[model samples]
Target chain A: MIEVENLTKTYGSYNALKGINFRVEKGEILGFLGPNGAGKTTTMRILTCFFPATSGKATVAGYDVFENSLEVKKRIGYLPENVPLYKDMEITDYLTFVGRIKGVSAKDIKTKVSKVMGDCGITHMAGKLIGELSKGYRQRVGLAQALINDPEVLILDEPTIGLDPKQIIEIRQLIKNLAGRHTVILSTHILPEVSMTCQRVVIINEGRVIAVDTPHNLTNQIQKAARIFFKIEGPAVNVVKELNKVKGVKMIEKKETSNGVTDYIVELEKGNENRKVLPELIIKNGWGLHEMRSVEMSLEDIFIKLVTEEKGVKT
Target chain B: MRNFYLIFKKELKSYFYSPIAYAVMTIFLIITGYFFYNIFATFSTLSFQAQMNPTLAKQYNLLNISESVVRPLFGNVSVIMLLLMPLLTMRLFSEEKRSGTIELLLTYPVRDIEVVLGKFAACLAIFSIMLVFTLLYPFLIKIYGQPELGPIITGYIGLFFMGAAFIAFGIFASTLTENQVVAAVLSFGVLLFFWMAGYSISFVSSSLVSVLSYIALTQHLESFAKGVIDSGDIIYYLNFTMLCIFLSLRALESKKWRG
Candidate 1:
């Protein structure tokens, strides 16, 4: 539903999007994950035809964003980072205004506005002015605004920002519900937001595309340094030495020793399990294996490592 | 055209949604009405003094409706509009930019010209509404005096177009900045400059005289105020309004280029 090619946007000497390329298929929700100032909003703006790309091309719903911007604009619903709304307008009035501009037929505007308002669960606040609603309600109204015309593509930038955790989950669910009908491309710096809500993600940083893959695969790839927390009743030095003897055990660092019990953090080599070997080795040495728990590789870790690491992956 | 209408309706509704439209209308009407009553009061006081003194009766008797009432009313309203139109038009684009709604607007499927026209049309409508209230003065005159409707009609047409011309400039000024105050001041300064330039027609040499008169907006209004209904004056306003509207459109388009 969206294609961006060599999408370079330069502001004088600085590049906001440096020849970045990505695509989203029909009915797929592609999470655009990056840290702040990472060109995610710039990419979304270009796709929505806010401005033409400086040196490249972008297409949405099969029309070039620059050449057929009006058509492209008609097919995509954009929720900007600020979720710009008229504070003075009542919800129904604002939605009606947006509906007409989005090209909903005159007779159908009422029904369409109500439908999106219902979908976003803002039916109760239809009579309130937008300024009177809370952040969460206003955010829902913003979502409803984007969904009013039922466009084929939704370009949402930081949709859940500034909302409470429950509101976040509600918005996530709302977006998840949008997937098999509208192709969704949303930008966020939150990793869990991507893992929980998106089918695929394009990770960008510092104006360049770093990685693009399924959330599952991206997390799995960075789980190579699987870590474990170990507690054994033994001398701390001896526990370290014994764990080193087991193949696939990469490193062990002593954490603490309370009385005779020692706490150690162990790193396991990729694709290998010394988990089975550790219990047998402890029994032979007669040291009690008090507690052993493998640490789950979290998407947070993957995101931090992926963003902090300096390796630039090509396409 | 439908897009223009939709945008125009929203803009027009928005003006009333806040204190802008009402505040501007009230202030404009109060100030212009003061001048209207003041002009007629002077005319009546002169007539009264002339009847009592008999020495000044000839001069006061010549205080006709066209000279003492219609001409000064239009001139006063013109100056009043020059000041008040900026207050109404300043927020047209500046408020959108400050609130960040311009992004949503530009991303909509409407063309740049449509947005410009929509905003200009709405501001013009509000100005016309304000002018409509001032017509009560003429209505009262029609009841009490035998005033020529031709000059009254033509004078109002001139007033409407000139106010509209100011509105076009105001919209262009709005496109220049995000602060409504700055936009208002900038538009006010520009209009004031044109007023000063027109007033300077008396002080300059003959060679520079024609140039200043042409540059002066009031020179274009005099014929319309006298019921001449010159097409040249009509075309001047049309060209001025269109030129400013076109420039404002270019200013909006420049953002894409500047980006």
Candidate 2:
């Protein structure tokens, strides 16, 4: 639904986006993850035709963003980071106005506005002024405005910023519901939001895309060594020494318990599976292995590692 | 055309809902009415045959009837508009920039000209409504005494063109800054220069002085106010308005590239 190639934006000597490239398939929810000022907003703005890229090509719904911006704009609904709204306008009136400007027929604007207001759960406040709304309600109103046009592509930048936890969950659920109907490109600093709501994640840092893949794949790719945890009732010092003797076991750390139990974290070489021999080995050593579990790296760990690693190499 | 209509309607509604438009209009009416009444009272005391003070006596003589009172009624219209136009337009683009709504607006499928024209038309519509109310002065003159209808209509045409020119300049100034106060001050400064340009040109006798007078917006307006429909004067105001709107469009378009 969206394709960006060699997209770059420069402000004098400062390069806000440098040759960033990414694409989103139809009906796919793609999350753009980055820290503050990581060019996420810039990339989204360029894609939405709000700004022209200094040197790049971007197309949305088969329309070039710069060359055929009107077509691109007609097909995409954009919710900027700050949720800009006319404070004096009522929620319903604003949505209707947006629908009209987006080329919805005059006959359909009323129905479309109401449908979006219901979808975003702002029907109750439809008659109230936008400026009088709370942050969460304002964000919902912003979302409703974007959805009023029934756009084929939705570009939302930090859709849930400044909302409370409950509001965040509600908005995340709303975004998830929008999948399969609207191709979504969501940019946010919140990692968990991307992990939970987006099927594909693109990590950008310092004006460049550092990683792009499924959240699960990113974690698996970054986890170089296999680690396992074991709770054993045995001689603590001997258990640590015995675990080190197992083949493919590169390192082991054991913690002694008050009840003569010991816990150990065993690290194995990459591509090695030691669980098959663990039972036999524990029996042979006369150590009672009460609990055993594999430790898998999470998306958070991978994200931190990737961002920090990129930072380290830069310096 | 539909997109322009949508934007125009929304912009017009916004003016009525917000206190900015009402406040500006109220203050404008109060100031204009005060000055009109004061000028009329001072002239009423002078003899109808007094020709020494030609401008003041002529103004009084023109105010005798309702429909022909446009001369004195619109004499102070420019000054009233000078204060109100900036207030009405200060938030046109500045508020959008400050609140980040400009991004949302640009993302729609409307052309930049459509947006500019929509906003310009909305402000012009409101200014026209205010002008309609000032018609009461001309009507009052026609009721009380006889006055020339030709000059009255010409005076109103001049007022409309001047207001259009001022509105365009105000919008251009608004686009240059994100702060409404700064936009208002800058618009005021620009309008002040244009209003004073004709008088200032008198001090200069160089060949450039005549060219500058042609460029001055008030000089063109002065001809219309005196019952003249000069094509050159009409083209001057139209060109000035178009120039400002074109510059504003460029400013808005540059934002996308700078992003």
Candidate 3:
């Protein structure tokens, strides 16, 4: 539904998007995960035809964003960051305005507005002014407006930034429900948001696409070395040194110490089966073996690892 | 045109939703009403004297109610519009830019011209409503005295076009900044410069004086105020309005690249 190739945007020597490339298929929820200033918003702006890329091409819904912007725009709905809204307008009024401008027919505008309001769970706030709504409700109104046209492609920049925990879960579930119907490209700095709501994740940093894969696959790809957390009742330095002497042990780092039981993360070499040896070694050394468990790599870990790894490679 | 009307309706509704429109209208009506009363008082006193002394009436041109009262009323209203138009148009684009609503607006399927014209038409509509309220002046003149139809009609035409030109320039100024006050001040400065453009004619050479006079906003309204409907003045105001609207469109278009 969206294709961006060599899309570069520069603001007078400051490159906002440095020739990034990505493609989103129809009816797939693609989570654009990135840190601040990662060019995610810039890329989405280009795709939505908010602004042209400094160089290269972008097409949305099979129409070039530059050459056929109107056609592209008609098929795409955009919710910008901060959820810009007409604060003075009523909820229904704002949604109707968006629907009309998005080319929803007059006869259908009322139904479409009501449908989106129901979809976004903002039906009860129909007659209230937008300025009177809370932050979460305002965000819902923003989402409601984006869905007013029933657009084929939805570009949302951080759809759940300021919401509380429950609202975040609600929004995530709402977005998850949108899968297989509208092609969504939502950007967020929140790591777990991608794992929870997106089918595939594209991690970008510093105007570059560093990794793109399913959340499960990303964790697997970056989990080359098995990590085990060993809590032993002994001196931390001696336990780490003794663990380092074992075969296939890549590294061991002390985590924390409390009541003479120390927590340590031991990295094993790929294909190493020394999971049994570590506990035995602790038992044989006269130190008490408190607990032994393998730590599964999460999307957050992979995200930090990959971002730091990219910075390490650059330096 | 459909998209333009959609935007126009929304913009016009938003104007009434905010207090700026009411405040500007009230202020405009109050100031213009004061000027009208002052002009009417002078006209009434002059006519009372003219009834007593016919020679003085001829010398003062008090014989024509339209000349003594209606013409000055239109002129005063035009000046007042110059001051209030900036307030009316300052937030047209500036508010959207500041609030970041311009992003969603531009991303919609509407063309650039549609957005520009929609906003321009909204401000023009508000200015027209304000002008309509001032029509009470002409109606009052017709009630108490005989007022010439030509100057009253032509004077209104002049105010309409002149106010439109002012609005276009105001929109252009609004697009240049996200700050509403800055937009208002910038447009007010531009309008004031053009309002006083003809004043420097006497200091310059005769050849340059005619060019300055042609460019002056006040000079074009002179023909209409005198009940003279010259195509040249109408065309000048139209051309000025078109140029400012075109410039506003270009400025809005440049925002895409400049972003």
Chain B alone: TM-score in each candidate?
0.94, 0.89, 0.96
Arranged by DockQ with the best first, the candidates are 3, 1, 2
**Backbone clash count for every predicted candidate, in the order shown:** 0, 11, 0
Which model scores highest in lDDT? 3
Cα RMSD, each candidate = 3.1, 4.6, 2.6
Candidate 2 chain B: 10-residue stretch with minimal lDDT: B60-69
True contacts kept of each: 0.75, 0.94, 0.89
Q: Please report the candidate that would top TM-score against the real structure.
A: 3
> TM-scores of the models, in the given order?
0.92, 0.86, 0.93
The deviation in Å at residue B192 for candidate 3 is 1.1
Candidate 1 structure quality by residue, lDDT tens digits, A163-205: 9998798889989999999999999878778889999999888
**For residues A30-51, what per-residue lDDT tens digits would candidate 3 score against the true structure?**
9998878889888988898888
Tens digits of per-residue lDDT for model 3, B1-259: 9999999999999999999899999999999999999999988888788889868866746667877888888889988888889999999999999999899889989998999999999999999999999989899889999888988889899899999899999999999999999999999998999999999998999999989999999999988999889999889989988998899899988978884
Location of the lowest summed lDDT over 10 successive residues in candidate 3 chain A = A295-304
What docking grade applies to model 2?
A: medium
Total backbone collisions, model 3? 0
DockQ of 1: 0.72
TM-score of chain A of 2: 0.80
